[model samples]
Every structure is written in structure tokens, then in C-alpha cells.
Target: MSSITVATWEQLASAFYQHGWVWLPHFLSPALIAALCDDLQQQQLRSAGVGRQQDHLQNQQIRRDQTAWLDGSSSAQQDYLQLMQQLQQAFNQRFFLGLFDYECHYARYQQGDFYQKHLDAFRGRSNRVLTTVTYLNTPESGGELVLYDEQDQLLQRLPPAAGGLILFESERFPHEVLPATSERLSIAGWFRRNNSLQGMVDPGT
Candidate 1:
């Protein structure tokens, strides 16, 4: 990926502050996106679940995508993680968001697959502060991401575009993935604050 300049960071921070969300086109390099796409194809994926931990269970009515958590096991994964780490730092520095870490997973939405509208985090329930999605492949049609505002008003409808990224406040927006006519590939991630109790660190999903 290319280095993000200070001016670019300022623009991103400003846009996020004003809108609580931002869409960046070609935010990642094509080579990196290609590498990540290749890595995703090689991984073993499973039916995606809703909620977290024990509450997590597959519900086809709500979602029908397959996913695999990224582990930084390959060079491509490592590079992607490093870029996100820098992004986390940038957010913290600009917004004082106190982001402690990030976690992401490769998501594949095949034909007929969709995820119903939902918030990524609930107030006082989850540590996830920010949500991110970076597209790896561009589908000709279908699989658009629809984002809604606090009043449930339509905000934006984003189509898949390789290297494009969308970022938003996790708890403030409700979003969904539309059924795909073709395959849609992307990385879904969250920036979280440390919500550990006593001395134990909170477990990641």
C-alpha cells in the first residue's frame, strides 16, 4: 500500500467528524488488494454468525455469507494488518478515540447471499468503536452495501469496487449487504477499545 500523507489523514479525519462515515476510493494499492484477494481464496471459510461468543449462531434469514478471520499468517495479511494499525493510530491521534486494536475477516458473499440491516456494535455492549469494509473484487452487479442513519434514513448505497474502503462509527449506523448476483469479496473489520475487566483482556471474535 502507498503511504498515506498527512494531508490525506486530515481530509479523512475531517470528513469522518462531519459525517460519521467516509468512503475512500482506491485507498489501497491494486497489488496489495490482489494479494489479499489471493490469500482469501486459499483460506477455509465457514458460515458467518451473528452476535458474539456464546450468543453467536448462524441465522441464514439474517445473513448468508462465509467468512474467515485474518491471522497475519501470510505476507499479504501482514501488510494489510500493518496498514490498519497505522489507521488505528491515526484515528486515535486525531479523534482521541482510544482504539486499542483491530480485527478483520475475509467475507465472501456469493450469489443470493445477503446480510440484513444491523449495527456493528451496541452502546455500552461492545467495545467496537469503528467499522471498516475494503472491497477486494468488483462485481458487475448486486452486492451493494446500504448504510442508514440514526433515523433509519437512507445514507448511501455503495457498490463493490476493488480497493475502495468505507469507514463509519460502529454503533451509530445500521447497514446491510444486498444479495449478490455474482461473488463479492471484501474485508470487514472493527477498531475496538480495550474493555477488559479486572485484569483479564476482553476476548476477540
Candidate 2:
């Protein structure tokens, strides 16, 4: 990926703060996108789970995307992580969000798979503060991200275009993935604050 400048980071923060979500279609370099795509194909993906910790379960009616966590085991993954770290710091500096860490995973949606509208975080029950998605491959049709406003009204329908990045406030908006007519690949991630119960940190999924 190309070098991410401080100005670019500021722009991302400003846009996200004002609009509640930001979509950048040319955020990543082509080489990096290709490398991540290749890595996703080699990884073993499992049915995506809903809810958190003990409440987690796979409900196909609500979601059918498969996923594999990005463990920073490869160069491409490490690079991506570095980019997120920069964003995390930028967020803290500009918004005083106190974001502690970021976690992301590869998501694969096969033909006919979809996820119903849902919020990534509750108002105070979770640590996830912001959501991020980067598309690795482009599908000919379908597989759009439908984001909703606070009142559950339509906000935007984002297509899964390669090299595109989507950022949104986790608790403020509800979103869903439409069924794909072909295989769709992307990375879904979250920026988290340290929300611990007793001494244990909240587990994010």
C-alpha cells in the first residue's frame, strides 16, 4: 500500500465525524489488495457468528457470511494492521475516543448469502466503538452494504468495490449485507475501547 499521510488520516476522521460514515473507493493500493485476496483464499473460513461471547451463535437466517480472523501472520496483514494503528491514534487525538485496539477478519459471502440489518455495538454494553470494512474483490452484481440511520431509515447502499474502505460509528447505525450473486470477499473490522467486566477485558467478535 502507498504511504498514508497525516492529512489523509485527518480527512478520514473529519468525514466520519460529520457524516457518521465514510466511503473511500481508492484507499488501498492494487498490489496490497491482490496480496490480501490471495491470502484470504488460502485461509480456512468458518460460519460467521452473531452476538458476543456466550451469546454467540450462527443463525443463517440473519447472516451467512464465512470469516477468518486476521492474525498479522503475513506481511500484507501486518501492513494493514499498521494502517489501522495510525487511524486509531488519529481517532484518539481528534475525537478523544480512547480507542484501545482494533480487530478484523476476512469475510466471505457465497451466492445467496446475506446478513440482516444489525448494529455492531450497543450504546453501553460493548467496547466496539467504530466499524470498518475493506473490500478485496468486486462482484458483478448484488453484495451491497445497506447502512441505516438512527431511526432505521436508509442511509446509503454501498457496493463491494475492490480497494474500497467503509468506516462508520458502531453503535449509531444499523447495517446489513445483501445476498451476493457470486463470491464476495472483504475484511470486516472494529476499533474497540477497553470495556472490562471485573478484570476481564470484553471479547470482541
lDDT of 1 at 52: 95
Q: For model 2, what is the error of residue 67's alpha carbon versus the real structure, in angstroms, after optimal superposition? A: 0.3
Please provide, for model 2 over 51-103, each residue's C-alpha lDDT reduced to its tens digit, 9 standing for 90 to 100: 87789998998999999999999988998888888888888888899998999
**Whole-model lDDT for model 2 versus the true structure?**
0.90
Candidate 1 colliding pairs: none
Candidate 1 ranges with C-alpha deviation above 4 Å: none
Global lDDT of model 1: 0.94
Off by over 4 Å in 2: 197-200
lDDT of 2 at 44: 95
* TM-score to native of every candidate shown: 0.98, 0.95
Per-residue CA lDDT of candidate 1, range 84-188, in tens? 898999999889999999999999999999999999999999999999999999999999999999999999999999999999999999999999999999999
